[model samples]
Target: MTTRINAVPRAVPAEEVEVPFADCYITTAAQHAALRVLRSGWLTTGREVAAFEAEFAGYVGAGHAVAVSSCTQGIELALRSFGLPRGSLVLTSTMTFCGAVQAIVHAGLQPVLVDVDAGTGMPTPATVRDAVRAYGPPAAMTVVHWAGDLADVPALAEAAGLTLDQIVVDAAHALGTSAGTTPIGSQCAATCFSFYATKNLPLGEGGMVTTNDPERSRWLHQARLHGMTADAWRRYLPGGSWRYDVAEAGLKANMTDLQAAMGRAQLTHLPAWQHRRAQIAARYDTLLAAQPGIALPHRPALGTGTHAWHLYPVRLAPGIDRDEVIAELAQRRVGTSVHFIPVHQLTYFARIASVPPAGMAGADTLFGQLLSLPIHPRLTDGQIDAVCAALADATHRQFTRKGAS
Candidate 1:
């Protein structure tokens, strides 16, 4: 099955009930920041880039942050930074986006897929332990914070017999999330964040890797920009030297000043945006909970962690075709999305890893029933109501009256 990044479009694009599945919450601050970057004349990596890096690192409580082109690049950089030998085992979640798995393969490591917890859509200590037991110790592992709910990394690491340094967190959905006292980026070897247009901190396109190791930070800083000793920020200064040396060969995944400016503005307003997202998700929980044959997102127990609510996913009961319902909802002009098709089920990975859907019990079960409702900061109360009403109607038409018009 093909994956659609945004929700499938409505048949006629309903005027009465048009709600997008995701919308970037941009404000005047972001506009002005972009304008400033445009007028600055020095558009590539510059002062704005440095400031955004510092501010994002502070927000996530990480020691250092290196801005990159996208979450995809950040993951690849994190894996490549480890310098693991070729064909080394790298276990990761089967429920996550393809980027994590792609990064492992691109880094010349063999990916061993692990099933996720059906409740949280995260690989558990048991799952990791089982994979490690089957595959033997891996050189490293990547844990994805699915739908902004963080996995208990320490527990997972211990269960898998690996140290913190051997783990990289795919935190694309978990910018502000935490587990107990530890935030997402601060605990892992390196945590990668996305600033995609629809992300919590939307900047059109960008990413950041946060880590405690200064050496790794320095390496990533250079590694993102073709291993140049000093970025244009330093090289373009009046006293800056044009002569620079390549410390190591690296990928061209550096974030531009323009993107950094918008990101900085988004970062400033993130707390408010997050609060709004939570409110929207709460409305979803209340709206969808009373109905039978549907499962809401499994929220983390209070004080255990915070949910970023990047996507509000629900699983339909058995016998309901998830795609049919999604199409029905789109007919009502209410947008919906699927968080993922198990990476193992996608044609490319299925061909490479060659794991049948039945092999990953949790992932297979979740994939069949998954659908993400319209959830974002820009959704109005009436829009939320329309979404819920459309869902209720879709269920009624699809299941309660199966053969009826």
Candidate 2:
């Protein structure tokens, strides 16, 4: 008989791993919360939405908060509340999501694009001033906290001669961002947040609008449910009258109880999630700061509360092609994405606003070299290291022959 060796066999060729740009963290808490809502049998905009709104308002230090179908609705409602005439100018950042600009357009207001600061990637007070000077007497101004960077809201509002009512902040990425010691929502007129699946506070698809003014809060509440004084919550309850009138032309943009339940669970974990995000972001900052042909995102010297760290975008140095780096990263089975392509560059805005290319310098420059790495609560330390290593390696391979700037 032949003696057979007991050595392990060689492995087959491994397939490329699929990495996502962003991933949501859902645990038993989410499942339990969702199950509770299911058992209650009241799934629409009911008590859950109300409770979540109250809790979120308290968390953000706002007098009131209104849960809506989406952040897009929040922005649209904020614009609608202005009662601004058709074609009235509203200044906003060029480095923002299309939804921000689209909301202005949807509300019959003309969008005036303003460039952001190169370092912070946020709309500066001067840029807002310049936009206002160019398109003076604006009906409103939407200040977007781009990629969780708190823009100079107070200075911009003051420079633009805008009252608190005229300053609506699209704080979609700024759940934990602060202006000095104050939170983002507390400083603006109407602060809108996104709980979209990819946002810092993911509710799958939901949003909130917070305001210090009680009157505005009440209006938003009614407006969220088609301007009906009493929503289905009251209409369907026992001993509740079905008699209700449509007070005004409103939108069908109310958040469901299911969405609110998820929001509540997410909110409960927000503090810890935010802390972890910051730690990861800080690590990225420290590790990536010294890399050749790489410039990591900069945190301003002001705020102490938290950064939210919704995105950790870095700018590649001159002569390094961002697309090539992204391609290399993809080839290495790493995930990457961009925060935005610039509002002014999108085809829809270009057609309607025809915003000149020259004025949006910050947005243009940043968009070409910007690439966001995977940074979520679910990412492990090893994953973070892998991302950092891949990024550095990609930069070297892409920019080695070009010479350093």
Candidate 3:
């Protein structure tokens, strides 16, 4: 059940109905914002980054938000601040982006990869309880709100013998999501967001860290830019001193003005974009539900949280060849993707977390069957039908080929 992509290349007609898996949402305002930065003298982490940080923090209801180069760096920067000794254990899911596992390693902590909910792709309370039972309590934990579904961090914390104070949320997907009316940013010790081109609120590349902890917040601001007491923007401003000092060896992970300009523009439009995505997801749920053997993604519980719907992943029934189906969908001019290849399956992690055997029972079983359909805000209604029709046709063909129907 390894999640290897199919290698053979195939072509689809340029004039045929084609549905892209992901498309970046950009507006004239975003372009104008970026151009405004280009026109400004300060191109680095200057006023725009500061503005985006403040605006994002206000939106997420966090005390502070630090803009970083990327979410991977944000997580690494945050974990390093904790001063956990090298090899100190940290619990996380195998069913996530490798950056999470790599960040734990980069932060000088040993990652104990555990199983996730096979169907929903979430690391549940059970996953935490088992990891705690098998490896003992970790110094910290990182939880991903799988596909923008809010994780019950309170239950997860209780199971892992930690508190909400020790959990960092890999909320790369849950920017607009909420848990029981509380936005995700206010629900964890630290929350990291990505502005990768495909995210709900994307720039080409950027990230942010939001937290309620003031001391950690201040440390993060200083730590993002060479641990300098004052950034170039501040130091070069009027009434600013030329003299400054570095307090700690830190990262060059500061967000640039240009990136922030784009982020701010996107942030302004995020609510509208979120609504569009929700509409698309609701349509997909209705359309894809009719396709036999395709299991739709789980929505966030009605009162528990609002789903960000970052991805619209579906699982094929047992015995279907997912790779073949993807190729089949491609032939029908529909693009498709898998959310992740369980971290432990990667050769580098296999060597590092080799002990405990990656007992990723659930992720191991779920790997081959998952596929993400296009659900971006820009997708047109016609394209939606194309994608679903292609999926249904592809599924019927794949099952027929396998003689499973």
Q: Which TM-score value belongs to model 1?
A: 0.93
Local lDDT at 389 for model 1: 79
For each candidate, the alpha-carbon lDDT, in order, equals 0.83, 0.81, 0.84
What is candidate 3's CA lDDT for residue 144? 90
lDDT tens digits by residue: candidate 3, 166-267 = 888999988888988778897778999999988888887889999998999999999998889888998899999988899777888999999999888878
Q: Ranking by TM-score, best first?
A: 3, 1, 2
The 10 consecutive residues of candidate 2 with the worst lDDT sum are: 1-10
Best model number under lDDT:
3
Error of 2 at 205 (Å): 0.7
Q: In angstroms, give how far residue 103 of model 2 lies from its true place.
A: 0.6
What's model 2's overall lDDT?
0.81
Ranking by lDDT: 3, 1, 2
The alpha-carbon deviation from the true structure for residue 199 of candidate 3, after best TM-score superposition, in angstroms, is 0.5
**Candidate 1 structure lDDT:** 0.83
Task: Give each prediction's root-mean-square deviation over alpha carbons.
Answer: 5.1, 6.9, 5.8
